[model samples]
Target chain A: MQYLNNIGTYFLMIIELFRKPTKWSVMRHLILKDIDDLIIGSLGIVSFIAFFVGGVVTIQTALNIDNPLIPKTLVGFATRQSILLEFAPTFMSIIMAGKVGSFITSSIGTMRVTEQIDALEVMGINSLNYLVFPKLVAMAFYPFVISIAMFLGIIGGLTACVYGGYSSVDDFITGIQQDFQPFHIVYAFIKTFLFAFVLATIPSYHGYYMKGGALEVGEASTTSFVWTSVTIILLNYLATQLLLS
Target chain B: MIEVKNLHKSFGDAHILKGISNTFEQGKTNLIIGQSGSGKSVFLKCLLGLYDYEEGSIEYNGEVFANLSEDKKRDMRAKIGMVFQGSALFDSLTIEENVMFPLRMFTKLKKDEMRERASIVLKRVNLEDAHKKMPSEASGGMQKRVAIARAIVNNPKYLFCDEPNSGLDPKTAIVIDNLIHEITEEYNITTVINTHDMNSVMEIGDSIMFLKDGLKAWEGSKKTIFKTDNKIVTDFVYSSNLFKKVREAVLKEQG
Candidate 1:
């Protein structure tokens, strides 16, 4: 019953976002701040993980190919497919469910506890719009982060392939270019866009509607991350089925 | 003037505020005092329209609040300034920006104009030097002052404060209470405060209402209370010996 109430409330919050207009001056500043916090802040962690994870994927693919008949180029092919299809978009969003998701929940939860949200409401400000809309605008830049992840992840893979002596540069490059479909990149970006919405609103719902004080804020953050990650994971599979499968 | 008629509110089976009726006069500091769990906060929230009363009409300056259109509610809310118990200044904003916030949102004033007004209001609260500081960087008293500056910066028609002196030392609390009253008179704004401080009840309560378990138990001016024979009011007012001394001194001074 509580879950159903949350789902209904989440949709209602989205409707509220469009009904009340916020001052553009304030909205612009809020958007810029959120971009800096959500996107730029996550760049370092995303890049670090992307690079190492890409290297590991390449090494694992090469090691698994025990047959002499399978082309060495297949290692690069498999690496590109894995990183572009699932690793960059889906996996990174899950990581962000922990990183960015926790941030959205705790910051907003703190505001709720501190009566800052109440202050906004009393001032005739739509607290939901003031709080959540900037985050939605900022998450529009999520794909930019994923684009960087794709670049760095592939670079890390090539570097690992060279160092591991699993495949030659030309062979790996051939495998990456082999039957490369533009539709796959399009599919990855679509998931990123959808995941971006989930990123902005799910955690916000938890924090905004949460009850209790400081300790509850922490608990809400944890619960928000869990639900956000689970939602992203489910939507990922759903999107893959609808868009890819 | 704000007139709440037969206002009743409940949270599920709890039934918090029951048939509360009162008129908060303009240019005066009206106080609602009660023990904890007496529904003071809930009543304040209902008056602010942050909570809806299930059975009552709140008339703000003669227009029923429930009858106002959504746009009108927004306009009315813009006129209502609130100083939360915790001050509730935006932690991310500087004191200057915090005070200038409502202006920037509701008015098309140039940035310099907003800053100028913020400066004047902050100076009114005796916080001229602390504009660049954050809320966390200020003392409890300074934060309450900033909250007041923010509340009044837009020249609101009504002001509400929930426990504005809850955390301050006695001296600082008195300063804050007096400042709020002065602002109320200076602006001719209808101001309502929720507090349990007998000092506040004795100090600036031009009109005081006491709530007991969500019911209006007593309603009178500060002067009337001193001469009245009501047990609840007398017991609650003289609950502390210090207040008793203060009341005796006031009576002695008056005689």
Candidate 2:
């Protein structure tokens, strides 16, 4: 019952977030700031995680297929599939649910604690729209970050495959290109977009509704991280089942 | 003027405000004074339309708030400026940008115009040189002054302050009180303040409403606050021995 209540509240909040829009002059600055905070700020960590994980996935795939009868190119195939199909979109979002999600939650939760939200409301501004809408708009660029992750992941896999003697550069390149479905990129991005929405809203829900002081802001951020990751994973499973299976 | 009629508010099973009604006049500092848990904050929030009251009508310059449409309510709210107990300045922006925020949101003024207007208010609040600083870098007194600057930057017709001097030293608190008083007269605004600071009550409370457990225990000006024999008002106002002796001396002098 409590879960249902929260879900209903979250939906209501999303609806409120779009209504009574803030003036574009103010909203423009807020959107730019959020882009800097939520998207641009996340690039470095996402790139680092994607590169190393892609390398590890390639090395592990190579070790698993020790038989000479198996084509060495299969290592590249598996790495490409892992990084694009799951690693770049789903795994990276889980990581962001910690980095970006905690940031959104803590920043907003602190505002709530200090009555900044009330200040906005009293000023006749729609606080939900003012605070959360920019984030939602910024997360529209989430796929841009994931695209970078996908590119770096493949590059890292290629470097590892060539350097680790897992496969020749030619074979790895062929494997990446071989039988690749354009639809998979679309499917991955579809999931990325959904996760992006989750990333922005779930944490905002925790932050905007949070009640308490400084200690509670920290607690809200942790809860927001947990819930955002959980929601992203759940949505990934649902999307995969519907889109892939 | 702001008038409240039979305001009532409750939270779940707890009734926070039984019924509160009072008129806060314009061009003067109107104060709501009560001990902790006496629903002073709640009453102020209800007046600001931040909370939904169970029963009551609040009239702002004779327009019943509950009767207005959402758009009208928002239009009304736009005329209000509030200074929170915590100052509630945006942490991300510089103090100058913080003061300019309401103008940015509500006006179509050019950036230079907004900056100019912000400077005017900041100067009014005696925050002439702190524009580049963040709220976190400001002292409590400075932050309160910035809050005042932000509140009046948009030229609101009504100003509400929730303990605008909460954590400041006595000297700074008096400065804030005097600033609010001056702004009230300058703007001819319907100013309502929620505070328990007796010094504020005595200094600038042109009209005072004393709430006890959500009910109006007494209503008077700062002059009458000392003269009132109402025990609730006297007990809360003179809880300190120094104030008690001062009240006694005043009574003797008056007698």
DockQ of 1: 0.89
- For model 1, residues A107-218, the per-residue Cα lDDT tens digits are 9999999999999999888999999999999999999999999988988999999999999999999999999999999999999999999999999998898889999999
Task: State the weakest 10-residue window (summed lDDT) of model 2 chain A.
Answer: A66-75
* lDDT at residue A236 of model 2 (Cα atoms): 93
Residue A58 of model 1 has an lDDT of: 97
lDDT of 2 by residue, B148-191 (tens): 99999999999999998888999999999999999999999999
Reference-based TM-score, model 2: 0.98
- Candidate 1 per-residue lDDT, tens place, B55-117, comes to 988999899988898899998988989999999999999999999999998899999999999
Off by over 4 Å in 1: B248-255
